[model samples]
Target: MTILCVRFQLPSAHETAFPELLGLLEEFTPVVEALPPDGALADLRGAERYFGRGAVELASVIRVRALALHGVDCVIGAGPGPMLARVAQRAARPGVTCAVSAGEARDFLAGKPVAALPGVGAATARTLCEYGLDTLGRVAAAPLSTLQRLVGAKAGRELHEKANGVDRGRVVPNAVSRSLAAERRFPRDELDPVRHRRALLSAGEELGARLRAVEKVCRTLTLTVRYADRSSTTRGRTLGEPTAHSADLTRTAYSLYEALGLQRARVRAIALRAEGLGPADRASHQLTFDPADEKARRIEEVADRARAKFGPRAVMPGGLAA
Candidate 1:
């Protein structure tokens, strides 16, 4: 089956906002696999007869549609399989399409650095270079038994096949639900922890409302803090129980921020992501004995209904009011 790998040049500030683009791709093919932030792989074999176009032509069509509709340009690479498609996509220029024919795949990969081959790590490249196997051509010419002795049995066999431009892996599509993320960027570098907590609270409230509105709950929460110097730190935690309640989500967000212990760090932005989402009906909420907890949940439901009718600004959490 032919596969097309498309890479998007998304701004880092708005990287998580691509649901509309994904929906658009779904119209052309059902086998769209999201690569998060900036890439996707689509299986185009079935789309050929349906769209009356070849793989390369279909890729160009997708690029044009994305540019016209979303104001986003894409680089697409088309090949018979996933590996070659990925390589072609990386080699493609912005707003362009590149394709590797079946016959030319080997020569295309021949003289590239060993590190350029997928699944070849820095340490592996260093080991190979020690033996003067700096290019894919040399690695491909190496005996399979020799590669196995150099690396290992499984990895060596895998690398040998990849160096020869052979990939047997299939493109698995729609494996997981897309995550929801909310980020708040400070106008200036702020070092106060109280301000950081407040920002996190707002982000949590926004994320919780979004999840509840869709009737979904997340199993994990990831917190990312971008510093003034452009460096960032990320931490994630899996909840004991999945929930879409604002209070529960806010509490988890607070805990994650506190765990970082950023006493005087100049923070630039904070982002929270709700991951591993599933249907709310399928998740089991733990029963609470505290009357206050029940009261809070009841109030949350009422607020959600009011917001649905009036607007999102109709209700606001007490902490967020300031």
Candidate 2:
């Protein structure tokens, strides 16, 4: 069975729009798996016969539809299985689709950094590099027992399988959950509250756009702050009403951050999650006669259109221009 893994380079505004993207993928195949934030995996075993197109051609079709319909470009990688497909997708160029033949899976994985393998993080890569097992070829060539001794029994065996392109996992079709999240990690520890609020605004904008894209409304917002010491704190607040409005999300995010009273805290990263999501059609908005509220909503709609036609940067919150 062939599987295609697609990764999207979502602009900050569309970071949480994975659900909308998944809906697009479902048009091509029923067996679509959502990769939250910005990606998905589709099983194309029988889709070839159904669509009368090869894997590569079908991938192009998906890319075209996504761009034409939602102004999102996708990179796709096709292979016999999920691991190979994900690896190929990572190697793909922007706005392009690539495929890996079954015979070439090992050759494709060979010579790549060990970090390219799934689940091998920075610390693991350092450990492997110290032992001269820094490449997939080296890992694949190593004895399983030796790898077990180096890493551990379970991780070592899994690494060996992945290094040799031996993944047996299948793409299971499932709906993305009701919540969406976005996070930003600072280049260094950030102590300034201005930078913190800026990050929160960015995340809020992203979550709002995503919720709107998917036609959902969130009734609550959660803010998580990761400190330089690796500890983290999370706070959540219930909104007055469910909303997909960026302004509402931004207000709630700022309030949550302020509640933390993070004076002088060196924050490493900040994340915002929108929860209690439901269809936007089901949400009820209070009647507002205020001209400012109406004006802001109108401007937001125009900005959304501008972003869809041009790119996410076509319109950004003024405060986040820096």
C-alpha lDDT score of every prediction, in listed order: 0.81, 0.82
- Give the TM-scores of the predictions, in the order they appear: 0.54, 0.53
* Deviation in Å, model 2, residue 213 alpha carbon: 30
lDDT of 2: 0.82
TM-score (C-alpha) between model 2 and the true structure:
0.53
Candidate number with greatest lDDT: 2
Output the lDDT of residue 30, model 1: 47
Q: Tell me which residue pairs clash in candidate 2.
A: none
Off by over 4 Å in 1: 175-322
Summarize candidate 2's per-residue lDDT along 109-171 as a digit string, tens digits. Answer: 998999997678999889888999989999999999989998899999999988887877788
